[model samples]
Target: MTTAPLVRRAHDRGIAVLTLDSPHNRNALSAALIADLTDALDAAERDEAVRAVLLTHTGSTFCAGADLKADGIGKGPGLLVGLIRRIATLAKPVVAKADGHARAGGLGLLAACDIAVASDAATFAFTESRLGLAPSVISLPVLDRVDPRAAGRYFLTGERFDTAEAVRIGLVTAWDEALDGILAGLRAASPQGLAESKAVATRSLREALDSGAEELVRQSARLFTSAEAAEGMRAFVERRDPSWAL
Candidate 1:
């Protein structure tokens, strides 16, 4: 059987919309997907006509998180960490159009974008703790976007939260039925203006991510190799709850 490319790119009116298309795995952040996303982002950045970038997905679930069962499980977290950093530092304005659920690492991807517009039906969660892992690498972006108090609650509990709650906590900018207007507005800006503006806006976030990425990636790698996380991942693939689940 032939599988489709994980990430798809489309350009319209100076906007480069990158869609995560691996719905078979809920657009999971596998190595292949991560590489494709990185390449797409680079292509958009180099395109003189591309004024803005839209990060979205094709499936009902935006992203289910890392491909834990993939052959390169240990490297998934680090690659995701790099991807989020790239999105945050991208010269063009990047918007996340989340039309579906985004969980665990998916939330990190959403948070790293310059703006996130989610649908009313969209849901989000941290979900790492439930797997006996931590949102270590992802925290670089997640912590900056969400309110500290809400971050504390969600980070520890890994509970699924609704779109309204996600907006209130700053996980997303707003819930909108259509994103064409936003994209149009973004397209109106000059490439130089957008680049300068985004550079100034995300300077702190870029610095923070760069400074903490090494440690966070190490923590993530360590957690993924731990006995607890091993058991949790095994249970997940086996279609059962984690051992720590009540």
Candidate 2:
């Protein structure tokens, strides 16, 4: 099989590993990376040989959100949203083996997964507000994983948080001493049983979101017009630190 921008391998135990391969850019979600990731996930979903999918990266930083320099803007065709949706609906369970910094969009990817095991060194941030952009697409997974009050603080402040906070807020399922061991244990489970359980859980979660999504959007829209957001973006462009320091 051809190696994609994101590499994929099926282990003997029917566990498929999808490794984000762009280390130089901190595995930022470039257009090519997003396209390759979507394709790779789709292939894993279709392959009968695969049971569970493990998402990981091969660098010190798991992902640094979207590649803002690549396209002059961080937005990249909304591919991340589509990829997250695919993972959410996949029959098999998807686990994120996050060992490094998973900021902004990267946190969204982790949130979308059925289970997430983060290393103690893992760090997360929602820096979109600092850059004058909204974490609009990522808000879905963020809301799913984090409490609304916690989300408001991080979303508005764009502050960085540690792995323990991630676990406390439900973004990470657990913190593992060794990611390999956790992954091994997850891979040992019955794929069929895991798939059914994940499907039911995801369905319930989606229903809850569907019921209140409109109100969420309305509130976010109002925030877009706030003076703080405008000042934050201006400070970002001027190469000065934002005044809204936590």
TM-score of each: 0.94, 0.81
Write down the lDDT of every candidate, Cα atoms only. Answer: 0.87, 0.77
Q: Which ranges in model 1 have alpha carbons more than 4 Å from their true place?
A: 1-3
Candidate 2 stretches with Cα past 4 Å from truth are: 1-4, 8-12, 72-77, 178-185, 204-239, 242-246
Scored by lDDT, the top model is 1
Counted clashes in each candidate structure: 0, 0
State the lDDT of candidate 1 residue by residue for 1-246, as single tens digits.
876678889988899989999988898889999999999999999999899998889979998888866745667777888898889878999999988999998888988999999987799988888888999888888888889999999999988888999989999988775477778778788888999999998887898887999998889888888999889888877999887778
Q: In angstroms, how far off is 115's CA in candidate 2?
A: 0.7
User: What local lDDT does model 2 show for residue 162?
Assistant: 90
Give per-residue lDDT, candidate 2, residue 58: 87
Report the C-alpha lDDT of model 2 over 1-246, residue by residue, as the tens digit: 955466545464677888888887899888778888788888888888887788888888988887755753433525666677788888888888888998877888888888888888799999977766677767887787788899999999889999999889888888866556766766677778777888787885566455644554455455555778678757866898878665
RMSD each, Å = 1.7, 3.9
